[model samples]
Target chain A: MKFLKLSMSATAFAAAMAASTSAMAEEYKMVILQSLTGGAAFIGKNVADGAAMAADELNANGFFGEGNSLVYEVADDATDRTQTLSLITRLAADEDVLIVMGPTSGSVALAGANVANEREFPVITTTNSMEVIENGPWSFILTQPADVTIPYIADFTAQTLGAKNCAIIGVKDNEAYVALQRKYEDLIQAQGVNLASVDGVALADSDFSALATKIATSEQDCVFIGTPAAQGANLVIQLRQAGLDPSIPILGHNAFASPTFIEKGGAAVENVYLMGAWVPGGYDDFSSAFSTNFEAKTGIPADEWHAVGYSGMQVIANAIKDAVAAGAVTREGVRDALGTQTDIPVVMGEGTYSYDEHRVPHFGMKVLQVKDGAFAVVGE
Target chain B: MLSQQILNGLVTGSVYALFSLGFTLIFGVQKLLNFAHGATFMAGAFIAYYCTISGLPFLLAIGFSMVATGVIAILVDLIAFRSLRKRGNAEFPALVSSIGVDLILVSIAQQVSKTQVLNFPFGTFPVKFYTFMGLRISLLQLVILATVAVLVALLIFYLKKTTFGRQVRAVATNERAAALLGVNAQSVYLQTFFIAGALAGLAGVLIGLLFNSMQFLMGEPYMLRAFVVVVIGGLGSVPGAIVASLMLGVMQSLTVAYLPSGLTDAIIFALLFVVLLIRPNGLFGDANAVAGGTRQ
Candidate 1:
């Protein structure tokens, strides 16, 4: 009887050891493909912060599949298109990565999207451009489309704020701004607003004194600046300095939502209108929670890019959970699950999501005003 | 529209002149294009930003930035150009080395600063406006114009009146002859680089203050504009560079105002093409200047 008891004890110990080994073997890995170096690094670092935070949350909450925990791998593309393609290709081929997340710029996102489609790996893009979502059902945009945001600015300036005469200043030959200019011009004219002037400034333009002078002389009640935060803020400050203030409302597109805009524009930024997908200080509980947690984790206030990155990871994480629940780890299963998602809570400044047939989640936008150097959501 | 265009041209032209003066000096003395010159300008702007943000006085920040950039220029020559010169490498090889240095410096600057645009403190200077004949000009423009004028006059006086200036001219004309005539060509080259770099550094600070934002890649546009001015004004000619810079700036401003902004650069390039056709040696090239004359 003693010998039999001892044998049973040994067998039980072996069984426990096997269970531990199997659990360790089932650890799931994910790759964050992004540009973490070079000029885009500041924005990319924030994106990385959001992605990492989501990964940590999932791991801590045991939100992964029944047999799987999560591990993250980061690949820096350095904002190079060719490097991004190569990196995505290698990451997709890695049998360990259950999913892949970024490649921040719109152009890089488009490239990664093509590779993800072939490999059947899911990619969630944080970029605002629509071209990344045009071709594939596997791809998702965490940010609202520029088309949606740009027109919203136009409508806000025209019908809502009642600015009849508007001048548009955009970056010359920039694909994103050029696309936005077309949409904005069409939308503004449809609202019966007189498009006083559409001025194109070169991307390398350093001085706005000339543009400001022209705007001061023109019969416009508002000016819409479609450029990055740096150029936009510079234009605003110069316009104000040139004595064109209190005469026209300076409305900015999504670019103005960046913290750099506030830091650069300072006091001049007050009363400037900006259209964005999410505003941090608002009633959105999910965004509030995410912002607080993000700041705690990264030790940096969350920016728009961070919010988008977090949302991208959330979308992927949700789809991963749904896929595992359905006992389908294949790419087709993940794609189907992501496509059918409805009202999934996004951690972005914009809450909730609804995906169309293309599996692209549509998160609408809101307009925010810069008051006392912070963003406040104006009434819709 | 015409007045606005001209005003734009003048502001842009002033910046161009600032950039080309450095380029002309380096080209005149060293007989090297110094592709890394743009990186020097970019670095200077970033250093200026760092200083201003760190609570250094604005004027002190400008001076420190220039001095720091001058040191970097000396280092560039010592590490990259001096070695090539010592080895007696072909001019093409030296040019290629400069390009390599350019890449390294640009990469380092971008890595350190990232891509964010940093703004100088507002109200650092008064934003007064002056009107002449119904054309409004900002205090910033007047400052830039005055600064460039003083710098150009100083450069001219230095070249014509100072012993070091004569040594630079002698080395530029013939390094071997200057070396034989008790002039240290290497030292002359070093001084030229220092002066040129300091000028670029000053331009960077001026541009950052005037534009209200500075980026790591800001130097590329100025570099291109300076190149165009140098080609049009006649290479190695300081006075010629100033004239060409102002002309190009006015041309760009006028084009942006009168024509669509998209066509402004195209118009400028077209004008360059016309100038090249009319005078292949450039507008201010000497009588003995040869077409496609190689820098010695």
Candidate 2:
């Protein structure tokens, strides 16, 4: 009887230990490489916040299998391409990290894409360059490429705004701006708009007096600004002050979508039309929830990058959930699942994500205009 | 179009002249290359920006910026150049030191601004334009030109007519000898730095208002252009700086308006290189090494 009782106790203890082991959750690791401490830090901070918000929401929703959790690690790339590659390599070598997101800029994203392919790890970048996916199968981009978006901007400026002649002002010596200027040249010509002249302004030029005077006197129907936000704002302000008709339409690139432009440009940027990647007001239920929760948690207004970051992470989460459901949750499995993910719900645009054969997300954007000191949807 | 461009160039050139004058002035007095002069200029803009944001009147903001930048310039000398000057090892060491100080100032500005571009509030300056002889100019341009003219005249009068100006000239010739002659070299250095800083600050505020963009890095490009202007104008020669500044401004405007965009920088710098090669003493420069060392 004594031996039997002792055996019974040992069996109970063994069963209890097995039950405890089953109750503990398995954690999947994700690593993010973003530009957090350099020139792009402002955008980088938003990206980081959005990703964290998605991760938290996913974990809370139990989207992963029962007793499974997602964990993340973040590192700053300082907006440097070489640094991005190094960080990606380090993250890829880690067996624990299931997937990676970012290296925010296009130039840096190009390098990151190659690293993802070489290491057989998946990288989802928010870079606006379509060329990012050319690095191969494992590389993905979440934002609209400039080529796709610029045409729309040009078409709208020509058709909707009825601008006949347009002067192009761009920052010289920037590879991106130079490319943008050429794209504008092509698109404006296609729309039968007379390209008055292309003016290349130096970066950090405090006096735009000459350029402004030239543009104002050109008698163009519109001025298209192909510079970053700050420079664009100053250029427009100086242009207006130089006696350009206040009613002349000012067409802008994606960079002007930032509220900073409206704030800095003040009364001058009043009729500025911007083609932007994200439309916050177009949020679906899923996006609305993410947006609400994000603001509640971070106390910062969500911008284009916030939406992209959250969407990128949501796609990652869905892939992980599918991988977990298949009982094959390796990095390769998550990547394969991402490859097969179609029409996954997102928070930006129409709130659905579909990937091309190249694994680049279908990036739908919106036309935004600043009216009454705030951003409002154009052609609503 | 050419006339308008020329008019624009003159407006922009006046500011360049104002900036380079201070730069040459310091070199005239001490023969020291104060790299931090750009930072001093930047600080003026920053101060003026804050003052405006804090509800100070527009002209008051300008005054505050000028005074603060002037003081900052004196501090730069006390910290970066003074010890080296005392050791008589100021040339290269002072250059390196001023650069170091410049970096520090830039870093501080970056932190203060959070690496964001700032703009003056609307109505910081009234915007009105005038058309004359088929050419257009803004009220701000007119004001800038008038202000520069007045400042230049005042500077000329002070330098040519005053006892302190004579003392400064004496010290510029030979500091040790000037001190022996009871010129009080210390006061001369302080006054020259103060004036230089104040002028730079005024230029900073003007440029900031003109562009409607105030940023920590704005002074960098002006500093670079100042080099070209002072080199062309004959370093240390105030009148030479003015002429060279106007020339460079016009050249830049014409280049941008007519030449291939990529060639502007190459052309400008090539001009600088040619000037250095052909006339190392510069067009208006003295045979003496020190800027403004010769009256002619």
Candidate 3:
């Protein structure tokens, strides 16, 4: 009889503990859609990592208070546009999921934004297109747009580098790359640099021998290659091999500011001017602390993509926090809060974030260079 | 500058020739398209990349990659083509099967690579230049030129001088007749596929090292180019493929240099269309290819 009574008491105690734990808080999740397995995987993986880390940071700091915590549910679209649409629809149909953070690829992000607008779901994207903003107010972009950053890069290339004549080369098929090259062309020309060759190559162009032959024989003071890291590095190496003087500066877009660039280019990337925004010890105290804590937590080094992703999440979570405080944490409530939230402190650029009157996220910019085989801040 | 561009085109066309040789060979022997040729090409690069990173010597890595891709090509034929060939009306079904096989190989590589672009290690091939007669040429470029030249010569010699080559030609002429004459048609088909795959494999390695970028989808672009090369070179002619490849390469390079951007493909396809309209059998192809022929 005594043994039976002890067993009954233990069962009741276990049940009570379960109930207490379950009643402690409500968990809210926003989908962290990304291209974890494709051409953009480098960006997607880092972005997802930073966003998830931001969620963990919020929960640890008691920013969500005692009643709720955010969950950044991660998903991969494999860098496919069609898969991105399906993911957005499925995530939006979840009544509990109030927002979607990314489909990091520019083209895939644009497709997801269209669906998000039709579904009236709020989305924060990392794509570099102004077209996504045209999709509607329901979709928001958090990346430092090229229009704002490329001018600084172009000016730096022309003024600081003393490049009197500039040549441009990039992928003609990609709209973002074409826009970047055009912006550089216009701004560099505005700085009194005569244009030499505004050459465009195919997206799948691996053989730079033909293009490099043209550039090496051309009379340009410097050349701005607007391809991504590996391609850009290979081009630089080939151009050098093709007899372009090593003293001639190679200016590139922000995509060149990556560890992969350093790894792939090695000695070739030395002194190549690149556009970038984040580095652990390169930014403000907030960023420094965040980077330190971030490194301590995740064991992965912080990068530009990590900063963009963390800032993007803070923008989303701050709105969610406000909704929670107002006792109306619904999808529309979060969307309304996101529209009003501004000037939130972040770990990007000059250490703050906000959507401008045009509904585009704003951040500071910088120019980086490969100094002694490592990334170093050169200009802004 | 024009000469340099032509030189660049020749190097590129050499790889194009390497890529297209096998594609045309399969068509010559089997009269079926192997859409998975690109996948095998990609597989070659991936295999070479992995082998190199694992501390294999560069030449050894190239050899291993070629052999592995050859086996992969044979497997493709066995799985995707053999049954279709048995069914007698294999053209449509074989095309679909090859596509399915290509997708499977691509998907597997994607999963293995996790979609990261790969590169050969620095100094895998020495980075040295040779300047002569106001022209700058890298040692690697010379190596590529020499390698392609030797391989093409050897292939020609083998085709003209070997007994297996005779069987291959007979099979290409008429499979049933070759089989009735004890030519071992299956063996010929396998041998042709093996040779084609090995060539594509080497092309993949050279491109991966040349471009310093290798990814799962690297072969897709070449597949489209292969169609252009084969159709323009004449469906079943090796020498024609080489000439057409170099022509296409030089034309593409010059267009990129002189004309507006994005017209490279248009010019190339236009040339192909003109070739088709005028010389239906290709520049080097015999009239028998267009007239009622074997295999079809």
Candidate number with greatest TM-score: 3
Residue A287 displacement (Å), model 1: 2.6
Full candidate order by TM-score, most accurate first = 3, 1, 2
Residue A347 displacement in candidate 1 (angstroms): 4.0
Candidate 2: regions farther than 4 A off:
A1-102, A106-126, A136-142, A162-164, A245-248, A279-347, B84-93, B182-190, B287-291, B294-296
lDDT of 1 at B138: 78
Judged by DockQ cut-offs, the docking class of candidate 3 is medium
Higher-scoring candidate on lDDT, 2 or 3: 3
Measured as a fraction from 0 to 1, the native contacts recovered by model 1 come to 0.49
Q: What TM-score does each model's chain B reach against the true chain B?
A: 0.93, 0.97, 0.96
DockQ versus reference, model 3: 0.59
Clashes found in each candidate (C-alpha, N, C closer than 3 A): 0, 3, 0
* All models, RMSD in angstroms: 4.2, 5.6, 3.1
DockQ of each: 0.42, 0.37, 0.59
Query: Which of candidates 1 and 2 reaches a greater DockQ?
Result: 1
For candidate 1, what is the TM-score?
0.89
Residue A217 accuracy (lDDT) in model 1: 66
Using DockQ, rank the candidates from best to worst: 3, 1, 2
lDDT string, candidate 2, B16-132, tens digits: 998888899998888888899898889898999999999999899999899999899999889998889999967999999999999888778866875567778878898788889
Could you tell me how far off, in angstroms, the CA of residue B140 lies in candidate 3 after the best superposition? 1.0
Candidate 1 per-residue lDDT over residues B200-286, each given as its tens digit: 888888888888878777887788778888778877777778889999988776665556657866777787788788987568865
